[model samples]
Target: MDHLPPHPGADAAESRVAARADAYAAAPLLGCLLREVARPVTDEPGVHLLPGCGKLLRVRGGRRPAAPEVRTAGGWHRLDHAELVKLVAEELRRHTGLSNHELPAEMADSRDTVAALLTARARATAPADPYLRSEQCLLTGHPHHPAPKARGGGPAATWLPYAPEAHARFPLTLLGVREDAVVEEGDCSALDALGAAPPGYRLLPAHPWQLDLAAAGLAGAFADGRLIRLGTTTCDTWPTAAIRTVYAPERDLFLKFSLDVRITNDIRRLWRHDLRKLIRTDTAVRAAFAALDGPAAWLSDRGYRTADFAFEELAVLVRDGLRGHLVPGATPYLAAGLVEGFDGSPLDGPADPAAWWEAYLGRLVPPVLAAFAGHGVVLEAHLQNCLIACDGDGVPVQALFRDAEGVKLPPGTDRAAGWERLVYCLVVNHLMELAEALAERHPGLDPWPAVRRELARHDLPEIPALLTAPTLPAKTNLLLRWTGADGAAAHYRPLPNPLAGA
Candidate 1:
């Protein structure tokens, strides 16, 4: 991590800046701690008992919990970011009977990365467009993940140039693969229109960061006549919240590239197995959406292209652009951005907070449940994968979903396991988080009742039990990272379900 210079001069100001980074970093870890590990002492909110450790932890409660403190013998010890990380590590060690050196380091790296981002953003200007600005405003991502902002422990210089939070944009490095060497499936013809290729080669665009990471392996291909460098795109492409996927406004296309760095739980490379199963998964989702009523849409993963030798390293997926799928006058906003917040967000100040919440639940919930119950297709309808389109009044009119790589179909996925995933993704991850954000903005407005009402409207047999269930399965992101578990293997801890009575 780069030791970013403090605000102008004043050593005092520098100390304050460092403290702010620590607080920003601590919030997510604290959320994970409270959700996954700690036990509540009383009905009183924000206070929890760290079992077997003989300690009490308290935080300012909300979607992004902050200002953590630990009760001690002498008095209450306020934890700075480093102290908090130490506390978490100690607690996990005592609780699990295992020590993980890497996660704690990642926790620190995440803090340092936040500090670097804050420094860079202070000098940078945010984009004027609300949608693009929303995509760039996720400074503290995945509210429940302990190390959401860590850049694979790489130097700031290596990753900062491509960071979405830094509001960075760069032209993709175009490559020409020998006709015989190119391997692709489905409709990758969209890639060819980006740039022209040589006589017997096909045009393939690669994320500059991916190219840098894979440069050593690609050297052999370049040495031989198998691959040719064709320079970069004519215009800059904006990276969405998912850093590997970029949006080209001029061409109205989305390109998802294979990145070697681990953003959150996974290496983030487009694996060969997932890419091979993509067409089948995407086709099923497309058919599900087609059968559904109303304007809800699926931004299909049209196809992908790559080199035969370096399949996963060079793979790039083409996704449907927003322009075609969006309703006539509505503006599409990334659902995750709406939760993380930017300058302009519908949830910021809804005309009728209750009505807005209803419309949101109405549009977003049905398709996910319908896809699961009716089509046997479980869509990863989490916030980042969803886009909610709102009209002039900031009322949600349409819902569009993307990313087929995360989709799971029948037989390949066990029935019980698939339902668990749907409930986790749709209710716990998506609705619950968005509801918290909305409720935080509009005090006294309970968004879960509307969520309950929306779920009740659907005829799936699971709906009744879901409404009466005492606990909801929340993903154990912090522990999963700590234990070095497979990213796709989700282990959950029970959380108090807000919709239990509703």
Candidate 2:
């Protein structure tokens, strides 16, 4: 593994920060390795036997496991973040008969990125808005993925100013697309209100980071007068957990841009193929939510606008603001943020753990199942894509799901395949993480029973099989990255189902 050199002015405090960053980075990588590649040794708690090299691996803690160690001829030796990466690479190569040169570097980069984020977070003030605070609280993102914090291996300076975990808020660079060169669909009239466009031009807002990354491809357009630079937005926008997407409080708008950076599993560009089908997918989700009888809501992706010449590179998608869909006086918090605790998280200390867990399940589970069974639409109800809104008393009153780009329709994808995708996102990625967090916070609280009961309440045909199934499908993120598979092409392995006997 290529270790990042120590900071030039490193001190005792910086050394402590490095230690914390190592712990933070190692947890997800360890979780991924244990889940996807290692098997538990019978009657040995926290001990796993690697099948490939017959090595015994041990870790401490559950949920976010830490302090990985490997038993060797001499004795048991602990592995630091770099050594852990090396161990993982060796094990994966022996197990899969393949060598991955890139993932190790990403693992190192992720660790270095965490170190930078930790330092920045210490110096920066947290957002006063609870909702914004919740959105920006994901320091250890995607707890099951190996390199969740990897920022395309770029220097920290390039991405730090836009990182949500650092409490970043900045103005967007506005541009003018020549009237005839503008491409748009659906309801994109909201873009016009951001700024004034000169005669024969349309206002186009761009993420400054994306503009910087795509500067080479866009130079010709700037010189040829197809795109002109306008001044930045007067009001600043907050970057959400999804770094490319920003929330503008001044206009009560959410704008998603085509970022060139690879965050978590994918290079998060707004690809043209997905954009062409955006309306169809968003409409299906909207109709499903409209027909459902509950407090569940769908935040619509209204439309997108970009220059025809630079479609994917310059695309900006406009999404619905929170005010319209949220329950009266209810505050919405990112579900992922709730798992990764924030200053004012509702999950931190609920008055009644049972009631809170049930209320959470009641609000979140129904809509996802209903969308799939009742309307043949599979909503990506993962934690990051979901927002749970709480009433004045800290009760979960509503569940709002967004990101239409991740939605799957029936005929395009077979029902069985779509159902599998839904199960992974909704049950595994979303509920399992929340359940673990809730259970960890409140000792002696068995979260599985409530989850099983919630699944039973749903009338969908898949519920019975899901509740009784011995194993639930879990996406193999570590193996996927090691094998250099396409990020969107999900590969799942069977994980023991906790709901089986609950």
Candidate 3:
């Protein structure tokens, strides 16, 4: 790996962008103590590197040390770099309390230890999710503060706007800013509008590159709040925490907390809980599902991609379910936690198959269709969000709807925003997850087939039958079955995965 040390003060202008990347402690506190450590020369690796910030690693071979081979962030796999000079630069700053002028490359060879530790850390959190401990870089730029324009394209999605709730605590909007941009006491204030600032609440907007540095220390403190620090459905602000949220099995709720007062979608959805008909999208979606005449229940949620910190897409979090709330009639398994996908976490583990699900379709699908046909309100009656609950042991008792977020209604018939949302929430997103699980778990069970079969079994209308025609392509079939054949998109890739032999 190439090692170049440009003195900070001698070239502040040169260090502007690179400085934005605060020097960090290696993974494992000091990382593996190899020959040397490789530090980030520039922040915004993807953008800064032009074609994209790449993962540059410095590995030490037995006979020859490893050279830094750059790989694009899109699919770069390894980070075995050894000459991370920034770590030394950061330590100097912390020890001397100096700006670029203070950071000195001292005793120099702290690598063998830093590298080993860093590698261990990477392996520790490496599973479906990997652990990432990073340092920060001080950068230079014109930060919008509250509204940072999105990189590449798309409109700048400004979340965490000042709200009535933020009256007490100043609403801090994260800009694409660097270190110098942090004005002294920028967010330290008590607004005459908002009463007392919550004791533990504080806001500090840093450059997107700095979040890892912040997360290594602050994430612990943020978890202390009853409603601790909120994160954007988008990870652009901080990839570490964003990655954790997406992969954690615990957290299941997310919100963009949009700042634009006019862009009040999150607020509207949250407030809809008050209105009688739309008390909860969960409830509405549940009712809509129960209304459907089918053995298939809505499964996965579109909101739950288990979040990715790439920040390439909308980081908006649609609050659809309340975690921990239990449905008495539902199985405890039904009361299971939800993984907000890449973005959130509900309960834990999925509803138990042996302990929660009803017997086979022969007996189960019949009553389910009958229930919806009778009421015309399949409120989250799908297989995923809703539960096939039993009494004490593992006897399937009833189809209990747990996520009172989305309630379902018959298609073609438009209700209110609440109902339309219910259709989207239930039939589309929620059922879709369940359909995929069923397809994945019990291949030939035929979830959509069950949906249609249930409709015919009941006198309910055959509105969803358009999905099973032949001529459909393969990618569509995969995505459809993959997502559990949701309500609306069920039309896109009509062909179902073959359930024949297996």
Tens digits of per-residue lDDT for model 1 on 294-314?
Answer: 889999999999999789999
lDDT by residue (1-502, candidate 2, tens digit) is 9999877777788889989999999999998999999999989899999888889999998799999999989988998999999989999999999998999999999999999999999999998999999999998999999999999899899999999999999999999999999999989998899999999999999999999999999999999999999999999999999999999988999999999988888999999999999999999999999999888999999999999999999999999999999999999999999999999899987899999999999999988988898889988889899999999888999999999999999789898899999999999999999999999999899999999998898788888899999999999999998898999998999999999978
- Model 3: residues >4 Å from true position, as ranges? 1-331, 334-384, 390-395, 402-405, 408-412, 415-455, 463-502
Worst 10 residues of 1 by lDDT: 6-15
Off by over 4 Å in 2: 1-10
Ranking by TM-score: 2, 1, 3
Q: Please write out the lDDT profile of model 3 over residues 1-502, one tens digit for every residue.
A: 7877866664664343222222222221122212112343465332112112223443322211222233445644333323343433343344334444211221122222122223333333322311111100001000100001112111222221111111111222232212222222111221111122234433323222224323454443335432233333232222211111111123332222211121101111212122223333334444555565433344222231101221212122323222233224333232111111211111212254422222423334454445344544444333333444333443444443433333444553343432333333333333344444444544344455554443345454532332333322211211222223441332232223222111
TM-score of each: 0.96, 0.97, 0.30
Please report the candidate that would top lDDT against the real structure. 2
Candidate maximizing TM-score: 2
C-alpha root-mean-square deviation, candidate 3: 19.2
In model 3, the worst 10-residue window by lDDT is: 135-144
Model 1: CA > 4 A from native:
1-13, 43-45
The positional error of residue 164 in candidate 1, measured at the CA in angstroms, is 1.0
Number of clashing residue pairs in every model? 0, 0, 113
